[model samples]
Target chain A: MQSSYFTGVTTSNGVMQHDFTVGEVTGALWSSKRAECAPLVLMGHGGGNHKKSPAMLGRAQRLVVDGGFHVACIDAPGHGDRPRTAHDEQEIAALREALETGEPVGPIVVRYNAHLAERAVPEWRAALDFLQGVEWVGDEDPVGYFGLNMGTAIGVPLTAVEPRIKAAVFGLHWPEALAEYARQITVPIEYTLQWDDEHIPRESGLALFDAFASEEKTLHANSGGHKELPRFESDSAVRFFVRQLVRPSIPQPDLVW
Target chain B: MQSSYFTGVTTSNGVMQHDFTVGEVTGALWSSKRAECAPLVLMGHGGGNHKKSPAMLGRAQRLVVDGGFHVACIDAPGHGDRPRTAHDEQEIAALREALETGEPVGPIVVRYNAHLAERAVPEWRAALDFLQGVEWVGDEDPVGYFGLNMGTAIGVPLTAVEPRIKAAVFGLHWPEALAEYARQITVPIEYTLQWDDEHIPRESGLALFDAFASEEKTLHANSGGHKELPRFESDSAVRFFVRQLVRPSIPQPDLVW
Candidate 1:
């Protein structure tokens, strides 16, 4: 996995955000020059969202400025800068028509998820391979992951296959294809669960967490919708990664916002 | 809400399983002779399942044999002995076809859920009214609720308007229609969440938990599919109702299994 670095994007803080593409996977890396050889985190975005979405950026900004960690994030297949394949377009069009016509979306969603996971799991691994050797990172950088919704879908399976990631903050939901594979994942994980998600069932979320073969997993559930998780929970997630990857000696903020 | 009892069915454990029709809802009642005028529990089954389904029956059996509670479960609208309406048939057929053809099932599920919720919630309320004054129950009996998937969708709204219900054990997922009404619910709630459900997303399930206005709600999440929740969780739910409704004055079993 080769990468191209463009440091044109500047942030309000001293941290520098750079754009990089490894083949079809496009992602951004945020890091502070002062924080060399810092622990690195891979940010996975939700479905229908890009790597630089407001929510994703908010998290990246905090990790870089407050948590003092280098962060890398990428767009999944057919999302953001990655070109949507013809098959992807067809599926999207069909789903839209069904929704307009008042057809059931469950079956469509299941199939689309399967299709996406087949590609996404591998794509994330490739991005991780590319993110590892950047100048801000080291040959033995302590790696972590944080993502929700579609991000968890990819992260769950990616973590199962790629042992390089030391820890992960995954929450909410995952792909059906990952059912068997989840039992094989023993990564120290911090999984978030929203109490009442309208789209994802509570049982489904718990099932994913239970499937994780990880002996060191903590369930951080809060009251909210799919996107309505509390800031304190994310702060808790930040603290989790710190404790797991970089050691909790770093004084963290009360909130990541 | 009027009721007629037919006591033709009796169980081996001295728990009599009787048939009853309460307005539009038809359900079976399970009662043990040892618990007279005991606390009553209302059982709501998931979609595509009826009152006497193995899962629902197991819950009722536990509440009766161990928890010293009389259990009442009614079929939701368009389920079980209640014949499906023409509209219900059409929607089910379409969903079946979609599943067969690999078409999107989400659109069909949304419509069916909308159709079911419109009638099922009121049906449950009527059943609650009928169950209150039965021969085995007093006019002022304490009532609890247990249901999943479609059950939560109906149980949530039913628990919202019908404050007579003392406590509830609900989980799985809910329909989008319950978003506004959930905030009105103040009853003590015991909700379950499955981690890796294929049909419902985890965030959506958490959103339902967040929507509830209950200040005394506990989220009981487990690892499994929508249908694969561990029995231990259900045992915990039974214990929850016992503590909330009956106060566990009776001896509770070690493992509800």
Candidate 2:
């Protein structure tokens, strides 16, 4: 990962955001200055959002300061700063026309997903490969993973491939729909869902959670649309990462040390 | 259709929403007093929401008053007042449990959609069959159809088999996925799609529109969630239906009778 002495304010947790080029992907890195070597959490944002998006940045700040872990976020392919595909243009045009005239826009959306599916996982893996070699980053094991909707799509496969991602937070996948990839996920997972989601059908989101083979997993769901995750759920996620990375207090032996 | 001196406050447009049972289906009929013999438009609501839902009611009021068409709406099978299926119970339980515990709810969701696919069309046909025998509700030709989301699921097949429906306003279908039914719709169609819709993948929705055989079709796509359609789009539907149903006033020639 090529990190730059970039211009940006240090966050409350002493997390500094810097522009980065990991492998062929361009992204932002948020790392804490206080810790020379810290537990790291890699975040993937939802579809149509970028690494520095408010949600991504907020989580990065929390994890770095509160959880004592460096956090990294990258835009999904054709999203953020990445170049858009030809299909994306056609799809957007079709979509605009549909909105103007009230026609079906399903084909474009489905195609857009398909296009992203082909590249999302591969790109995430590349980002992971770069992070694994970083000195100040916890390159070894127990690195946490945080992804929502689109993040879930890319992160699920990443978890399956990378052994370092010890804990994860994500949801909104149809395990059955993408059986080959969804079934292979076995890391400790925390999946969030919206019960009354307009697009992500409630049942499908739940079903994706069941597809994970992890023995240690939990579902954090609330009542709302795709964007309306309750405030408390973020606390749940923070607690999860802290619990996962910060070893719990060990009972001192009665025999004494 | 069962006509009754229904007890309810009629809207400013004289649109009356009356409860009725068409064969085995229970639904509401929204008609205007000023245009009892005017063009009739049958309406269908999206998933989760029921007939006479605010969205449905508002549209009904608009069409009856501004466009001069009596509108009717019915709950899809296993929706609204219709009895919930056994599968719905399991799906709901699974969803609630999944939300609480982070389990997979995909299978149940997939099963639910499949179950509806089987019954949705047949029930819609039953409603249409009952409507065909009504004296006021045009048993002959030039009838109009309007549906969205689940409405599309039931209405698509209804449009295919019912020859009287001259035009339609609906969408949220994957034609290739449901080729048999989707391919059969030949009437002029106006399909609405939400660009950022989570549940209905954009491509599949577009593909569904493509599956129709209609030569005259328009796509009205918008940027928002599933429920967040722009206000002006309703005016677009009103225009389409009015253009289809209301004949243009002819210029009086000197020699004309």
Q: Which candidate number maximizes DockQ?
A: 1
lDDT per residue for candidate 2 within A1-257, as digits (tens), equals 44433234444436677677765467777777765676678888876778878778777777776677778887777778788878767766776787588664434544565567568777766776676666666465468888876677677777788777788888655454344665787666777776566665656765676567765565554445666665445555777787666663434222100
Model 1 spans with C-alpha error above 4 angstroms: A1-257, B1-3, B248-257
The two-chain DockQ for each candidate, comma-separated, is 0.02, 0.01
Tell me model 2's lDDT, rounded to 2 decimals: 0.67
Q: After superposition, how far is residue A204 of candidate 2 from its true place, in Å?
A: 1.0
Candidate 1 per-residue C-alpha lDDT over A87-143 given as tens digits, one digit per residue, 9 for 90 to 100: 989888888888788786546766776678789887777777677766668658678
Best by TM-score: 1
Model 2: CA > 4 A from native: A1-13, A93-111, A248-257, B1-257
